[model samples]
Target: MNRRELREQIFMLLFRVEFNQKDDMPEQCTLFLEDGDTEISEKDAAYIRSKYEKIAEKLPEIDKLINETAIGWDTQRMGKVELTIIRLAVYEIRFDETVPTGVAINEAVELAKKFGQEGSSGFVNGILAKFA
Candidate 1:
């Protein structure tokens, strides 16, 4: 899968975090991979899992950044979809060196448009714009 596809997959996987307990993530991730609409190759699956894990690992710091940057919007009070997208973008922008900042913000907005409420894209763009 391409980077965008991978990001989408990661986003979907990460979305589960808001709904499940920390201990449940391993099973959740495995079930998510097994139940995907399209069959994923072992290599892509591994990549997705690793990247998801890395993102999950950094979520505390990511959420911190979000809390700091988006005034009046803590992770708890934010919409689940927007919070999830912001978490991924924050990780990419602040942690992942390979992803250009523009690409991270743009892809996150795309994800927001695809999975979030009608105004999600703009909300995501507005929040992300504060980062760079």
Candidate 2:
């Protein structure tokens, strides 16, 4: 799979982590890859697994930035899915400098559009734009 597809997979994996709250990341990451029958290359799966694993390692800092930058919304009040999107987006913006801020924002917006409520994309776009 390409970058966009891989990112989508990462998003889903990260979202599952939030739901499951199991901390064994290597096992969880492997489970995610194994469960998906999509034709992602092993290399792409490895990249996503590493990124997602790193994101989990720094979740406290990631959530702190997300809560601070989320304007009027508390991270607690946000839907679990939206919160996960913001966390992943903020993690990308802060930790992965290789990804342009705009690309990170756009990717988050797209994920919101696909998985969030009607206005969630706009909301996510606005918050991530602040980082850019």
Candidate 3:
């Protein structure tokens, strides 16, 4: 899988985090990889899983940055799609040195356009711009 595909997988896994209990994430991650219609190579699967784990480990700090930068909007109040996109973008922007800040922001906006609600791209772009 390409980087974009890996990012989408990571975002999907992160979205699952919002719904599942922490204890279930390992199983959920396994099932996600195993049950997919499209097969992912072991190398790509490992990359996705590792990146997801790292981002999840830093979620508290990520959310804190969102809370601090988002002004009046609380993290809980944000749409799940938008919040998930933000989390992914934030992870790339702050933690992953391999992804450029501009590329991260642009890819995040693209993901928002693809997966988020109406106006979600703009909303996500605005929030991520703070970090950029």
Candidate 4:
């Protein structure tokens, strides 16, 4: 699937993890890919799932950085979707060497536009730029 579709899957997976606190991400992902509404290939589903799980695993450190980097805001004050998007972008920027840092932050901005509150895209972009 394309990058936008992949990002949607990532957002769904992270949203699920945040709200449900599910631990069996691989199994959950397999079920979601097989049964959910999104149209994506098996390989792409696996990639998104892996990305979500990896980010979840490093959430503490990631959220810590997000909390520190967010100048006037705290992690708890941020909406869950925005926080999750930031975590995913930060993971890609810091750990996933295959994706350039600029792309990672831009992707997060796009996601914020799609899923965040009005003006949140700018907020997300501004925070991510610090890491870029």
Give lDDT tens digits, candidate 3, residues 1-60. 888888888898899988999999999999998897669899998998899999999999
Q: In order, what lDDT does every prediction score?
A: 0.92, 0.84, 0.92, 0.83
lDDT of 3: 0.92
Per-model RMSD to reference? 0.8, 1.4, 0.7, 1.6
Stretches of candidate 3 exceeding 4 Å from the true structure: none
Q: After superposition, how far is residue 45 of candidate 1 from its true place, in Å?
A: 0.5
Residues 23-95, candidate 2: write the lDDT tens digits: 5666777877877767667888889888898899888898888778877887889887788888888988899
Most TM-score-accurate candidate: 3
Score candidate 3 by TM-score against the native. Answer: 0.98
- How far off is residue 67 in model 3, in Å? 0.2
| Candidate 4, position 83, lDDT | 84
Q: Candidate 2 regions off by >4 Å? A: none
lDDT for each residue of candidate 1 in 29-65, tens digit (9 for 90 to 100):
9998988797888898998899999999998888988
Arrange candidates by TM-score, descending. 3, 1, 2, 4
Instruction: List the lowest-lDDT window of 10 residues for candidate 2.
Output: 17-26
> How many backbone clashes are present in model 3?
0
lDDT of 2 at 126: 84
Residues 1-132, candidate 4: write the lDDT tens digits: 888778778887887776664566667777788888867776887788778778888888988898888899878898888888888888999888988998898888889988889988998898898888
